[model samples]
Target chain A: MRQMMVGVVALSALMAFPAMAAEGKRVSVKGELIDTWCYFSGVMGRPDAVVGSAHHTCAMWCAAGGIPIGLLGEDGEVYMVLKLPGDDASNGGETFLTMTNDTVEAEGMVYERDGLTYLVVSEVTSNDGIPNRTHEDFGVVPGNVIPDAVVDKVLEEG
Target chain B: MRRLVTLLACAATPVVAQAPLPFDIGGSFSLVDQRGDTRTEDSFGGPSLLFFGYAQCQSICTVALPRMAEAVDLLAERGVEVQPVLVTVDPVRDTPASLRDHAPDIHPRLVALTGSEDALAGARKAFRVESEVIGEDIEGPLYAHGSFVYLLDAEGEVLTLLPPVLGADRMAEIAMGYLEAKP
Candidate 1:
């Protein structure tokens, strides 16, 4: 129930984006780099709550598990991110794995098809790492993402 | 309300909006299917769903493969022929013999393919998919690989790519839209 309550804040762009061509449009976008699966599937939490410092660890797990990263644009569009600069593994690259959850300004080719958007980031023009610190509000959206042992250890230390 | 109605109508009918893929993603390659039969991109005689992952992979492949199979089944129910193909990134464990054993569990019609490491690497390169050895568990060597499913036409042209995050229902809906223009 808590998961449902927290996760109801839908990313409107997921369903709102209309059909468009596959032509690559060059644009510089400012947004949070996100784990596409959790954000779309809503298995973690709400769109606003699951991003930033709150969902960073789970984002790593998803990235490492071969889940595609996405750039959630400030306008509420989620661009399914392909390769970023200096890392073109075609799978999830090391660069994207490290940059997940970090809010950044990325310039790239954007393509929209079948009501979905995609991006191939040429470079991250600027990065303000994880400014949307929702952890204070949501406390690890998907509380199980962090192991109880680790949480207990942190609590014991305090 | 009107927009929703129009979108639903477009999806329910044949849509001529077969937009070109944004990237170069497929090519010809000779690989062995689950039946130990030598097959190439031309082998699938109908619209197809293709993925790049090994039979033993426990990562994203687990998520993507089953969803692709389900989409294939949903299309089948609607009398659309869509072959489901998996070209393995782990050629070592996913040989024809092994794929034959496992393909039925995923979907009876699944055509899981594998080949020499070099041959498999070429297939991945053509699709722009990358596979790297991450670590191993008792089950086998795990790999991080491309998890997107490619929707292809009879001639093996990639119509579009499906993100692994999509559910089978949405995947089928998207594929159905593309397919209505075919015949």
Candidate 2:
């Protein structure tokens, strides 16, 4: 009787929190396709991570180099873009290469782990042309241009 | 046996559907502003839209920053004041002077920030933004980082993440929705 009671209590506890119950779902989302690593890492501190038509070559290289793809939804949700089984390798990187910087509608199965979301992309369609802003003239500057005072302060703190 | 199989399948199915799990996205930081003054998370007494990008960025930042400026302007027109902030990912080159030069082109009221490498790294980690130096031997070495704009409440708690796909007008509308809903 005691064992049965414990089992019932455990079952009730599991029923209370439902989020841990399933893998994910099949859904469609409309958004801009992005390279995950560069979008996440380079945008914060690096210029090369910027996403747009100007950076299409770099993005394509990254995608082909095995970096995962991502879709940034209009609602601010980020989905990790993936290729389904039997999908051509060219469909993800090669296709995205041509479609870089454009908004797209994608259908996929969405999953989440460790606070990050992933989408196994089954289909994709372009929604609009690329936005008209590009930074073609922005050139890299030398890294040693900081004033002596700031350098001193940083070294002192270090 | 059939009943047991059904029970097992039901047990394995996840209950919650749309919402992803809670994430660790925002935290406190101390950095220098475009004016070379030190500022903290509490410097802005109201809601702020924060994003990470470098002044030398030739791609997304160019578009994102201008749209951010427009969003700020739109919010102001609606009688909602929202601070727009740009935190540089390239600490080695994006000095206060650089920020000052670049920020005004985006918006007169935009605040640009940079700090020591350690401080910038700490802030990035707090926000879960990824950044790294690439192509050092190339003509124009650049840092790559995340491109999401984060909306934070007065107390510096993250409210939402904005992707680059949202236009200035749409961004303003969403931001207004959040501000209006604030108690």
Candidate 3:
């Protein structure tokens, strides 16, 4: 009876391992905007308290010494439609793109690849009062390129 | 009752608006550039464009540094000597080999540095600059930072911060302005 009971306990412990590993860790982050990479904010999160402003956050990625990236989602997951920086009028804002945003949010696993951090977002939602806007507001101006002269003439005539 | 309510509203209002953080200028700290070279405040011959950054920097560093280097080359072609420094904020990961492989192609005269975190912290404190590292979705975590190509006088006093994206001629002009100024 004693040996049988021990066997049951050992099997239960083995079953719990995968469950424990799946549970991701969450922690608070905050910091100053030191640099920005590829329209992505490289604001240094304070190790002590993970918090900072959006302006600071954006400023970090926009900084001269910062890295830029396209926000990566999970395999086969789709991100919002957006434009990229340096997109020409001919291309209509389609090149150099990613699912990047400004608002700080909670995500799943935070990992680094190719010397840049990739935040695996299980559920990415915005914080603070700012609603999640598209890359258009961030100066990306996604989709349907309207020529400057045509836009001006239409506005003037209208 | 209306006057009492108005008085309460006035009391609830803030006394003053928040001011921006004052960026401090001109103190000195010892640091190592990406080249594994130990540079003090006195390294540059003329006014130096002291830039604090790292090898892992993807966006601004890669783009801006090359632009700045191109501008510097343009200046050099015109017979001007300007020293540029690239200091790594992430010292632990930014090895000298990494800098040599990735950074030197930006410009001929550019200097790279990576040192102890304390040294970097000291330099940041001295410059009144700041930084923080955060978790990312693609990689692990990255340092979110600001861009400034600091125009420092020969004596290491900051004149002004150039914008992250500017033409080489304009950058050369800014550096020239500081070079013309008397310490």
Candidate 4:
């Protein structure tokens, strides 16, 4: 009888926490992409580049290039490619609407692929749709967030 | 799994032409840390362990910042006051506010700096670092930039360099060794 009660209580607890039950825990991955070049490079191989600084530059870029778009998940997982409308592009292809400020609360399973940790994202959305904006929104664009100082230095040395 | 991933990444380095060395430390630039204070070559007192990165970066920044903090704690145990200076190669993006937001998560003492593209270029050149903007693709708009921790003396001279993949203990050893040794 006591054992049955414990199991019932556990089941009740699991049902109570919907968000926790649905949303998988997220882990942040902060590094530069060292390799996996040819694979991703081909995804947007077309020479077309949307040039301009508007609110929808990323939208235009993706549309003009037909490139898949998504943000790097906090869990270091690859989220599904989000398709934004062509009208999503602002003037001059600036701003970019695809996941720009999306929080991407995802629920999924963790997997190890090609030796690296990967989270197979199931669902994603912006947390506030405003707070997640990166430094790019402020007109301060990063050539590369992870400075290639060491590699550059190494190359320079040889 | 992490180790295997790291090894594979290392082995896959494309055969690119080697670059020249004995990089410079000064050319032109200005930056600000989490405290909103401007950091120039002059502001960095004592020996500085310089790391070029941004707050938005997830993997290297998250792992390295905490490890750096732990390393600092270790150095403190040995009676050393070493500063972990982070200079953002992505100046146009990183700002005093952003650094402030990210600093607490990394380490309170982890100083972040940023400047203009010209300034960033000069600083990277001084250190001979490289980074480029990649467009959107299946993976993402990743910055295939360099990753390494640079050790600089009181005079801003390069002491030692560690790649991003190195662990905290190794970094602590390098940092503690230099702090103990007077050069």
Candidate 5:
């Protein structure tokens, strides 16, 4: 009888804890990886702001600065990119920095919260025919433009 | 039976866990409005759309402010009253005079707010937003901030968060749905 009671308590405890099951569906999404800050704010003021190699440098800097990256699907769905559990943090962004401004296929679990879709990327594969512009070609490194004072302010405020 | 009691507890556990929790988005804010009047969360008596951006923001704020105004007009046309509010992300630059000038251009009904850095920071914290100055130029400094159009109830609790990408019509529709659904 005690053994049965222990089993019941264990079951109740397991059930009481929040579900550890991964939220959302696992699917492959194809789109241009974008740093959502400039993408949504149109800060770059470029017609090809969020997509294409021209926006690469700006997007990279933004993503590296902890701005949430997004995948702009061809169907107009914007999937906010999130790092999967136990992913390497050596690079500020896992797949977004590497795949910025290029059309790529990303396999991930997608979660929708407050009308925003989040893509927790597991794998990334780049597509062909997208021009991978060099830093020289972009001609502007946004990282260089960020003043130390600004960085200090951000750190202080945060 | 003991087995039945155990099974019932297990079933009830998940249901309680799955129940949606309240959004902790907004709270009381003491700030100065466009006219330099002190306003709190209770200043607005009905549903209000609250967003944070700076006047100097060329990208998102430019598009969002006008869209917010449009949403207000749409709501008015439908006979649903909603206040559109702009809380400055760059309070240092967006003074009361600047906000007063800039706000009326977007919408007659729009209320632009600014305050001391501490006050603005408190408001941002209450709204769960982070605004950081990222770059500077001849024009001015640029800020990268989390941009969300928050729809609030009469008491200032966040009802829903609308993405900046949504157009005025869509925002109005969503706001109306929330308002109409309320008992």
Candidate 6:
């Protein structure tokens, strides 16, 4: 039944995909910044483990590597972050690189397109820092993203 | 079984209820191609799929370039000819000669591009894509760049941008939807 609906939508899209003005709404949301590629791809670990401090280092790599970031909203819907506050650019910048894994309260214009939600952050109202702290449980998600020398020294100390 | 049938019954991509994004995203760029021939945004005579990635990038470039190429093939099969283009972020490493050797492997018809830092910066800024040297891996200097695949017209107008995460089929479908909508 659901597949049938998708098929129907697909057919309708073919016929009437006329360009319309962009429609959006302004709202505030609280969520952790995440690497959308890893989060959606599930390449690193279980969704629960690939976030917070555990995923922080890898998130930095992914962010700098041109992967888009998203806000895993408290509502559980991942909002594709088109732009972050104070940044005129879209994909990667120091602002987003620094904010990776930090939970933030932001108000922005939200647009829904093609089964996805996009957020253009106007201002980040507050930041809660990296509070999720999955590193304690997940141990750096892939555990290899960090250099072996660093891990080896830490393990030696332990 | 029934679900697969339903998907095959309709268009190649899904969710056509889309509006043109309200961002200003296109501009003229003067870039050089693999053969060291100068090319600009208007170089492709027909519709094209453009990606911002480096030839040596092992990250999103690996994931996106092939998909963009496949999308080009898919569009060709549908009688919609679309060129696939890649503009390199690593101009120093992805020289014209290196891209000349590598571009064909990614796609027989791929137009791999490189340019002066100032010229490439203009292009990136026009498209609002950020390019920065993020780190160094064993491979050499790694860069962070924009991964969205842009659908462009002959005049370099951006029709739409597709996320790299989408499958080739979905990307093709979205391209078809926009192309077919044009007059």
Q: So what's the TM-score on candidate 2?
A: 0.55
**CA deviation > 4 Å runs, candidate 1:** A1-22, A153-158, B1-22
Candidate structures ordered by lDDT, highest first: 6, 1, 5, 2, 3, 4
TM-score of 6: 0.85
Per-model tally of clashing residue pairs: 1, 18, 55, 34, 1, 1
Q: What C-alpha lDDT, on a 0 to 100 scale, does residue A154 get in candidate 2?
A: 78
**Mind giving the per-residue lDDT tens digits that candidate 3 earns over B1-183?**
232244234323322111111224446767666556677777676767767666666655666677677667766776677777777777777777777776667666677777788887877766544466744437444664544566665656565445444446667754553354342
Stretches of candidate 5 off by over 4 Å are A1-32, A35-54, A57-69, A73-77, A81-158, B1-23
User: In terms of DockQ, which candidate is strongest?
Assistant: 6
Tens-digit lDDT track of model 4 for B1-34: 3333444463343211111111123323466666
lDDT of 6 at A156: 100
Residue B59 C-alpha lDDT in model 5: 58
What's the distance in Å from true for residue A64, model 5? 11
Ordered by TM-score, highest first, the candidates read: 6, 1, 5, 2, 3, 4
Residue-level lDDT of model 2, residues A3-116, one tens digit each, is 122122223332443444335678889877765545554433243334555555556555443344667676656676544334333123345445555678877778552234
Two-chain DockQ for each candidate model: 0.17, 0.04, 0.04, 0.02, 0.04, 0.22
The candidate with the higher DockQ, 1 or 6, is 6
Interface RMSD of 2: 16.6
> Which candidate tops lDDT?
6
Q: Which lDDT tens digits does candidate 1 get at residues B40-106? A: 8777887899999888877788888989999998998998989999888888888788898998988
Give stretches of model 4 more than 4 Å off: A1-158, B1-29, B136-141
The lDDT, on a scale of 0 to 1, for candidate 6 is 0.80
lDDT of each residue in B1-183, candidate 6, tens digit only: 232233234323355455334456768888999999999888888889999999888888998899999999999999999989999999999999999999999999999989999999988887788888877888789888888898886667776677786778888887886687666
Clashes of 1: 1
Tell me the TM-score of each prediction against the true structure. 0.85, 0.55, 0.49, 0.45, 0.62, 0.85
TM-score of chain A of 4: 0.31
